[model samples]
Target: MGEPVARIMVVDDNEMNIRVLEALLSGRGYTVSTAHDGEEALEKIQEEIPDLMLLDAMMPRVDGFAVLKKLKENPKTRLIPVVMLTALSDLDSNVKAVELGADDFLTKPFNKALLLARVRSLLHVKFLLDELESVDEIIAMTARIVEAKDEYTEGHVERVTAFALGLGQAAGLNEWSMRNLRRGALLHDLGKIAVPDDVLNKPGKLDKEEWDHILRHPEVGASILKGLKSLASVVDIVLHHHEKLDGSGYPDGLKGDEITIESRIMAIADIYDALTTKRSYKEGMSKETALRILQEEGQEGKLDERLVNIFSQLVERGEFESLGDRIPNLFNIPPPPPR
Candidate 1:
């Protein structure tokens, strides 16, 4: 396919600024749109997502800072790169914009070449981000498909991701790590795609052969995700999530310190989601019952005690309840700790 045209949204209260930027962008083969202020920009965002947003720092009603805050808060529009265009070239404004997630900044007495260069650079970054987001959406959609196919796991993938990210944060993982934790949770069961439908959908307990087939999913998923470099980290999580702290887990029976923190966090999130979410073979266990299970696993050295304890705290405080509501397929309650 030919290089796609980027959609650019110019948000500025100054009529002259909007016209100048709009013409500049349209001339560069970009699809241009305009909003006079932050409020109008928000309205336009709901109608169409732009590849890049050029926002004026000062505007009546809703300012650029307010708009940036709202955009960063939303998952849907957060990935779109924002460039702050304003006469304010002071250090304070620059720092504030960067902190609020503006991808670039430009002074009002702008240089045409510099503006074009910055726009092109930001657009390229946005293209990479879009590609990455598409891959993540595909992985998430695949997980949902698998959950739909397995009658017992309507919301399993989403819940696990919520729990995993919470645990990741509680363990002092950075924002990037927390995001990676969610990716791991989403792809944790991808290998199950290779399992036979009969085996996957069976309502009864798994026999030896079925168990064997189930155990292969980690490796199968790893292989599948490894083929896509974009999902390399997720592949490790899929392959090693089952490994326990005491060497009791399968697929390699990795034990204790051998497991990565990412894998350990995924293990707890996966098991907790599995227990609280209903399956064809069994109804969802109560919240209390799930927490007990996690605690027991921690005590038995199957899971990281510190992470499990933090997860349990989050459950006790109802932090996870809201997440369960946002994501489908899991029980509508917080995950319980391993007994």
Candidate 2:
């Protein structure tokens, strides 16, 4: 099939400007929509999001800047590429538009070729970004399938992701690191799919050979994700999440600072989720017990001391309570009976 037609929205109070953009874009086989002002643009956007927006900076009432601000604030519309239309002398407004997340700019009177070029470029970028989002969805779905294989620990990926995100937020990680941390946490166990179902679901303790197979999961998972460029940021977290600070952990046995902070944060969440989650042979431990085990591991140089401490503090402050409530099935595992 041929490439999909790009939808372009031109937002300008001037009828002439809108008509010019419409003529320029529509002739090039683009689907064109127009709004006379920012308010109309916003309403049209809410009704049906456009692939790209051509916003005129100087409009009556709600101008381009106001529209850009609203667009950037709304997560659903935030990623739609916006090219601000400005007058030749409106450098300040252009700068403001950039600050407000405008993707590109076009100065009036519009050059037909330049307008088409900018439109094509922004549409290409938006197409690539949309493709990347689809890739993310595929990865997330794969993670879910891996989780589905183990009925005993359903929602494990989600819980781990939330815990990792909480720890990452508390540590003041940058947006990039936080995003990778989330993807890493969700797909951390993706390699487990390679393990035999009998080995994975065994009610008895794993024998040495079975344990060896289990230990290969991190490497296997990392290998599976290594092919995707988009997942490069989080690949280490999947691979090294099992590695310990003291070099006692498996796969590459990365020690101390050799492991990425993303992996370190994921390790704490992974271990905590594993401890609190019930299995066929063992019941779920209480949150207190899980925290105690984590503290002990930190003391013994197994996990990152600082991250563990931060996670403990977050737990104490009930920061994860709301997340737990959202995924009640994961956190609702009953406590084991007293001896």
Candidate 3:
């Protein structure tokens, strides 16, 4: 198929500036959206995310820097390529814009050819990133299908995703890390598809043979997508989520700090959901009880103390539930098919 016509947004307070950018982009058959100020740009962005953005460096109230900062901070809008258009040619201005996550910077009265070239370059990069996200979506759908093989763990993937993201955000994880965390949470159990139903759903503790089958999932899941460079962060979380700080847990005996923050966060989320979720043979535990257990695990060095502490505070303050409601489930994995 031919490349999809890219959607471009131009955010500038000046009507004249907006018109020039709109005319230029629309003339090239690109879909264009415009906002007069940072606040308007942000609001419009929520309505429809553009593939690329052209942002003015200065404006009233909400300036370009503020808008750039906001966009870069959000995982949803963070990946949209942004070009900073400014009148200031000073080195500091350029540095500040780059620091704020501007994909490209151009001084005003910019050469039309140069601007279009940069726009094309960034758009190409964005297209590649979108393909990666598309791959992630396919895997997420596969993970949901895997989840469907068991009746006892309804909504497990979604719950783990929400909890992991809450912990990630509470721990001040940046936009990129948060994105990978969500992907890892959903696909963390993709390897479970390899386990037999009888073994997966057994009511009692497993025999050594059954237990060994369960242990291969992390590596299996990791290997499934190890080829995707974009998902490298995700692979780490999937592969090491079961590993412990003290080298007791897992397919690999990864020691402390050997595991990444995203992996650590996934491990905590996975354990918490398993503890609190109802199963065929056991009722779900209370939130209070679950929190206490997590805390004990944290104190024992099984989990990251800072993250566990943060998660406990979020759960206790009633902040945790809303996280599930507010977090965007990108890729929009489809529901299970009819029986």
Question: Considering every candidate listed, which one attains the maximal TM-score?
Answer: 2
lDDT of 3 by residue, 1-339 (tens): 867899999999999999998999899999999999999999999999999999999899999999999998987888899999988888888899999989899999899899999999999988877776577678777877988987788788888888887788889998778878878988999888888999998989999999888999999989987998767778888888998888888989898989899999999899988999989789999989998998888888888888899888888888766644553563374321111
Candidate 2 on 1-339: residue-level lDDT in tens?
Answer: 655899999998989888887988888999999999999999999889999999999989998899999999987888899999897657887788899999988788878888788888888888877776666667677878998987677888988888988899899998778778867877899989999998888888889999988899999999998998777877899999899999998798888989989989988998998998888778999989999999999999999898999999998898887875676453222211111
Q: In model 2, where do residues sit more than 4 Å from their true spots?
A: 322-325, 328-339
Pairs of residues at least 3 apart in sequence or in different chains that clash in candidate 2: none
Taking all chains together, the TM-score of candidate 1 against the true structure is 0.75
TM-score of 2: 0.91
Query: In model 3, which regions exceed 4 Å deviation?
Result: 7-28, 31-115, 321-339
lDDT minimum window of 10 residues, candidate 1: 330-339
Q: For each candidate in turn, give its C-alpha RMSD to the true structure in angstroms.
A: 5.6, 6.2, 6.0
Best-fitting candidate, measured by lDDT? 3
Deviation in angstroms for 109 in model 1?
5.6
Tens-place lDDT per residue, model 1, 1-339, is 755899999999999988998888898899999999999999999999999999999999899999999999987788889999868678898789999999988887899899889989888877876666566667667877776766667667777777887788888986555556677787788888889988988887889999899899999988887778666666778899999999999799997777889999999988988888777667889989999999999998888999999999988999887774476543222221111
- C-alpha lDDT score of every prediction, in listed order: 0.83, 0.85, 0.86
Number of clashes in every candidate structure?
A: 19, 0, 0
In candidate 3, how many clashes are counted?
0
